[model samples]
Target: MKTIGLFAVIMSAAMTVQAKQVAPTSSKISPATIDQAIRLAEATSKEGVTKKITIVTTDNGKSTDVSPRYTVYLGYNSMAEMGNISAAYLIAEDAYSNVTAKRLAPGIYQVQYKAYRDEAGMVNVTKVIDANEAFINDNEIRKACADDFCDGTIKAAVDVQESTTSAN
Candidate 1:
């Protein structure tokens, strides 16, 4: 089992992918590079794979102003799904409300967001649901307006899936 800096690769590939039009664009990343990235997961073994990603928060107890920051360090079991990361930011609860998340390190992430405050009875805009591996496996992220007390309205989201090819 080998560990790779997939986060770095993913970020770089992110830029290269943005310049494409379903027709090869003028990027340093060649078609072969993209193909290699797609095949990276197939070559790696998932035996010793472990992923530790945490979401630390502040002012979450009171339905006041909710802001969560983390230095995210994520270890994926496989790079099989690396291509979908570019679309990760596009995940949102509704057409009017959304979260913009960035991964800095394990347990270190910065999440700046907007919730539809005017969306009828949606005052509790400080609640967010805990997301774990299971939630991701289901391809959905859940958000809330409150906690144990009344726990605000429940909202769910799914990441858009797209593919980009690359290799280190």
Candidate 2:
């Protein structure tokens, strides 16, 4: 009985360790897929067609009209002192728009935009704005953005603008 009890305890301990060691599976979707889905969803829904979006950067406190140039791309941050951190999503309102790529250090930023629906129930137009390094820290760039920097200020600004505009 004593041996059986000890064996059971050891098995349970081993199972617990194995469970802890299990790696999480990735649920990551590619940018192209996301873009396609957004486009498709917009095409299917009349409400999504006329939905306007506004992107605002909290760092500069200046808002630009970005409706005619909605394009998304991969971006990287390079600093002379800090070196290059990681790649991030870069959405723009224009193909020729200039993003202040070099000056942005570790900081928080906001991008706001509006999309207008066309007669075919598609989001034919979108307005996008970008801000670089509105907030930054020395941790993993992607992880940091996902956790702390992306949500608080940027989301608040977006929410406030959306609410105020929708009300008006």
TM-score: model 1 vs. ground truth? 0.20
TM-score of 2: 0.23
Evaluated with lDDT, which candidate comes out highest?
2
Query: What is the C-alpha lDDT profile of model 2 across 8-57, one tens digit per residue?
Result: 86565331111111111222335443322121100112312121122211
Provide the lDDT at 114 for model 2: 35
List the candidate 2 regions with Cα displacement exceeding 4 Å.
Answer: 1-69, 72-76, 80-83, 90-106, 118-168
lDDT of 2: 0.27
lDDT of each: 0.25, 0.27
TM-scores, each model vs. reference: 0.20, 0.23
Q: Residue 26 of candidate 2: its Cα lDDT? A: 23
lDDT score, candidate 2, position 27:
29
lDDT of 1 at 140: 29
Give the top-scoring candidate (TM-score): 2
RMSD of each: 21.6, 22.7
